[model samples]
Target: MKISTLITAAIALAATCPATAQETKTVKLRILETSDVHGSFFPYDFIERRDAKGSLARVSSYVNRLRQEYGDNVILLDNGDILQGQPTCYYYNYVATDKRNIVSDILNYMRYDAATFGNHDVETGHSVYDKWIGEMNAPVLGANIIDTATGKPYVKPYTIIERDGVKIAVIGMLTPAIPSWLGEKLWKGLRFDGIEKSAKEWIARLRETERPDVVVGLFHSGWNGGIENADYTEDETENTAKNVDGFDILFFGHDHHARKAVVKNAAGREVLCLDPSCNAVNIADAEVEITLRDGKVAEKKITGEVRDICNEPVDSAYMAHFAKEIDEIKGFINAPIGELADTIYTRDSFFGNSAFTDLIHNLQLAITNADVSFNAPLQFNTKLNKGKILMSDMFKLYKFENNICVLRMTGEEIKNYLEMSYALWTNQMKSPDDHIMLIDERNTGDMQKFGFKNFTFNFDSAAGIDYEVDVTKPEGKKVKILRMSDGKRFNAKKWYRVVMNSYRANGGGELLTRGAGIAKEELPGRTEYESKLDMRHYLAEKIKSEGTIYAKPNKNWRFVPEKWTNPALERDRKLIFKR
Candidate 1:
């Protein structure tokens, strides 16, 4: 063959062969996430019945600003708790039913890419949340929530999003403590598996099956601060990043805190984790860069931070969008139901039995006719002024959705319960400077400002029983029950019906299991009855029936040792009330 012929043949072969693809430029993808919005779809607080600081309107403004600047490669996500809390969702959930739920409509309008279910979302009952699942335009991912029928995830396990030829996989998981906080009926037909285990299994599966370039875990949980609980931590976002591999970023919720940090994953690669504070108060902004070589991902980088929406103005367009519905909800929540004969405040309840807590106790006893009532000031610092009581006051009084639960307990069991509660409530009066509230400011953090070392919601007190909590005594010996309200001597052997909320009955605060020494498994069986309606609803009806209420403390319980407690009370009052 001629030399020219050989050259022509070589050129033809080169033309026919596939060319190697090479990177031309780097691609920047932005991700925006909102967690634990808790039904704050609008800026208006339905309970307060006024415009508020945090809402989707403000978030919308922030998102709009980003879109205007970044040009729409932004992926938006919600980490659940959207179906409960706030009066907006409550009206939609139970009152007027719309074909397209307002929450679904709002999130759809916001253009959420994906979301997960939180424990409170599940608490809205299957019918309510199922509606959200059906109406949502985005994928609701939950790798650990198993459907009992099929033994597979009740929702989509994970979703892969491709942007500009870059494949990004987002996996979602809920905290496994659902059963511990909510009733079985609320989460019926579903099981929440461990976060770490689910992340491990799904990471391997996604790597093998999807083989995406970037993986993100959208967790409806908290950052556990390197804390471990059995196999899975309570808010296992941090732990999952530490123990699991293949995740590039993690977004957390359910604890209502704003935080951002980087942790080393199992592969020793940096994983960016962020939690936007709840109620639309904040948002997480994560920027990811993908470097490509030969048209394949060579390196990836993620930087994340939380942005405050407090200063941002409410999006006028969003406010105008939901104006009509907001007005209707306002009317319902603001209507006066009855009158408050006297003013009551929660600040007095912390020091001793006061009119604030006794009102709840009286309502519980009158409704259930139980021998005794166990009550707590759900509102940490709220006041119901004398005069007309509006429906909004009900929400202020009881912050959670709890049903009245009646349980059978003996005198000794009740005393044990009180002892455990007081131990947590008051510190031993060993010295004069003991800081009467049992607060360790360093360890308790900002929680001290709420007038308790722990969550003020868990500070339980009893009614219908005469007792004294001697802070001078040790933990086990602090509580001394004098007698029952009916002049009967408290008998240890006789079983007495006690009234409390379903949360405690179902081991919510651990008072029953840890304090009363009842096995966790036996809590459901010990419940004699449960209110058909929530306690809030009952309170409303009671007020409506009476027309006017004279709220007063029964004075059944007090702190002993007047010498120490009186002075301590005055000091603590100044500390808490700043009066």
Candidate 2:
């Protein structure tokens, strides 16, 4: 009787164990993401003109290894800005015979799952984007971008992928400000809708129809403070909240910030949002582990880690491929255009002034034969060294296909433009001790209202002119001409022949249209041509033949130093400019 009872118990235990085993299975999914790649696929640094960290080859190997570990449970994605940077961009724009799309080749090799569009991606104009989308192996997703002509969406709003028996929904969103930021011609006939509304509708549809186990929001809208909006006032902060209603994970790009935060929607539920820094500087990896019960996920666990891709070993194969491409493009960039003195110019400095800006000013002045030339110190990819400049270097300074345009403006208009710069420049100065000085009217919840903090201008002696800046004085009155290289002072009444890019000539930059009145002319060539012409070309045509470039200070513009009388202004000015 005892033996029979024991046998019955053992048989019952065996049946229960098999039922439990059938119900539970552990599955691991690893997600590897890159956002705003900006054509830095090869390990070479365009600025330094040498081997730097972060190449598609290295990135590929890492992803390949991750895939090997997790098998089919790995997803590789790029958040956008893939079409414009370095050798890949140049080849696609100029040299490609069939326009095979260099970026597509690299991405196809890496096997990207999905990507959203970035504002820079639109800079190449619509035709390139159309070709890129057709060439890509993965689907491009952006719910907000709509065609004005057809009144239809350009790409799919979301995609459903099945991995390891798990249904995952992925949705993409481009920043709504792209239309305004990139301008109409580039984003012509396209409307960017509100993110919240578009996301809500898509999420609702995904949940109702697809019933995905997990929902991810991939976005080109970045975090606050990193990329400030154009119109940030004292009280407004840029919105960084991801209020997508029902997303489990949100991956972001564009702002070039690496931050991990949790955002809550109107429904009082939490969503995890993550953004990694740019330039393959670092990588963010996340894993989701799910436990199944009766073929359904009964429990989920999320773990994330940030890896510095630069420290890892460079993949030899991809590195070799990149080297070959770099060598091919070398001759195109290295052909000596001109020579310069032993001076270093850089665009990275956000405060005070830059010699690089001086070079641009000189170039514009020479190119357009303008009396007063101006250029915004845009932070391009390269840094100038003490010797001869290369063609690759030119590409780094000017990446767009923008042309030069000359416009006419009145003296009053010029003064107004200068006044705008003064207001923007001085307002950024704040005193930490005084609450009133620091109180920003543009605090829009997610962004700080420090406007034009990185403004500076400097002149090179060989380039052309000299101007005395009373840094202590208020901005509008600070600039006074001391002397030009030709020993002359500036004359406000004189109609100067100024040259600038077509974008800025047409008022692309704020407060830079002051000298657009006397006469207007459109240069036949684009800005890229002017930049590619190099110092050699410019000197061969203008300065070298003339033997010197000179600039003189104009004392006509003068004002009292605000720092001497206003204590608050003095304190704020000192504090902000301390760095």
Name the 10 consecutive residues with the lowest summed lDDT in model 1: 442-451
lDDT tens digits by residue: candidate 1, 1-579: 999999999999988976545434477888989988887878777775567778888999888887786666788999998887787787788777765678888888888899998888887888889998999999898999999989999999999898877889999999888776678988889988889899999999988898898898999988774223344456788788898988899998887667899999778889999999778888998999987766678778889899888789888888888888788778878889899999999888889989989999999999989998998777666788899899878887776778999998888888888887877778898876666677655332232125355556667899888999989899889998889977889887789899999888887766777788887788788899998768888989998999999999888888878778989988988877678
After superposing candidate 2 on the true structure, give the runs of residues whose Cα lies further than 4 Å from its correct spot. Answer: 1-19, 225-242, 320-324, 347-355, 380-383, 399-401, 422-499, 502-579
- Report lDDT (Cα) of residue 188, candidate 1: 89
Name the best candidate (by lDDT). 1
Clashes of 2: 45
Error of 1 at 157 (Å): 1.5
Residue 437 accuracy (lDDT) in model 2: 29
Output the number of the TM-score-best candidate.
1
Root-mean-square deviation of each candidate, in angstroms? 3.1, 7.5
Per-residue alpha-carbon lDDT of candidate 2 for residues 135-215, written as tens digits (9 for 90 to 100) = 899988888788879877788888888897888888888777653234356787888776667777888888789998878
